[model samples]
Target: MALPEPGADRRTLDADRATAVPTMRSAAPLLKTSTAGALLAIAVMVAATVGAAIWLSIIDQRRQAQEQLTRQAHAAALQIRARLIETEQLLLLEGSGYAASADRFRRDMEELLDANPALLRVELRGRDGQSLVGVDAAAPRPTVAAATRTALSPEAAAAFDSAARMNRLTYSRPYYVTFGATGFDLMELVVPTGAVDGPMIVAVYAPQRILDHFLPSDQ
Candidate 1:
């Protein structure tokens, strides 16, 4: 106990060195495993980030596609409205001596029907709701404006009266037409004849034809 043997001390140092060597060897495997686990976590994060980006891109593309379709549809709608306004103006002009004679009026109506296939009938009616000039696209033109006398439905009467009273063009509500092409709706436009008591020009339109002419074919 007073003085340790030099050889004993050397053996003790050797034993301690052997123990430390195994501890370092064991620690190396743990370090390698920790590094590998860290790399795997990083790889998973990268994959998840990429997937999310792809999903977002797809969503953005769909949104842009929908917006483009909506814009196209809106443009088509504007064109349809412009066409309707033009037709109304034409009717009003025709009533203002564009066709002075009854024969001339009937001829003009026939021409209009021929030009626009969407029109089913065109009539010039007095303020009292009497048809002054009536022409059908499917049939021959009437002999004279006063040749035929027929009672109008309630809706037509109201529209014609309103147009005369308001001194402006009036639109009749949509109605189902049984005469031409089964199962279709028609809308009538009544335009004032300039004078307050003058006859009105009524034009019957086919909605499906109007859409087909104005809207995109693919849509």
Candidate 2:
């Protein structure tokens, strides 16, 4: 009838068993849940890192492509400039010899126009801004964008004005100009033609059709 002592083997065994069973049961679920959470977190981190890397790579590629395009444009401009310089040299060599005759200058300019038909027209503008003669004699002057209409848009006019004031070679943006004799878009190019030692201006016009060679396909 008296209670067993606290330290008795029978009571101690019962308490130990009760504590162990519940502890084991609770610990099993906690351990499993912790492992599963850790795995999910690792997977998410890996995916985010990979996505960021791919995005950065794409942006870098785009930048490189744009740089390449810029280089190509610069190269094209340089090539055109070199050809113009060569033509100027030829003109100077022949201009004085042909001063007594019109045939010689006409022949030289005609040859240049024939060699580069892509050029819509080439005009030798005197210091007084008078067009001496046009390379394409057949190309009719356009009434819409007449010779007086140097600037197709306001921006183009402003650029031309700046270049003209500086007495430097000036070029206009891509524009459509109806031929005086025919309706066709002419992409214009103007260069300064004169003595390297003195002020001079030369104007050249190229047809828009020629731009097809320089411009890339939309696709």
CA lDDT, candidate 2, residue 68:
82
Among all candidates shown, the one with the greatest TM-score: 1
TM-score of each: 0.70, 0.57
Lowest lDDT block of 10, candidate 2: 194-203
In model 2, residue pairs whose N, Cα or C atoms come closer than 3 Å (at least 3 residues apart or on different chains), thus clashing, are 140-180, 140-181, 141-180, 193-201, 193-202
- Please give the RMSD to the true structure for each candidate, in Å: 5.3, 7.3
What C-alpha lDDT does candidate 1 achieve relative to the native structure? Answer: 0.75
Tens-digit per-residue lDDT, 1-219, candidate 2 = 998776798888999999999999999999999999999999999999999999999999888888787787777667666665665566555444433345655676667766554554555444444455554534433233335443234444543454546645565665554445665554444344334323233334554544444544433
Q: How close is candidate 2 to the true structure, as a TM-score?
A: 0.57
lDDT of 1 by residue, 102-215 (tens): 787788888878877667778877777777777887543212122322756566678877888888888888766453344566777888878656777888777777777667
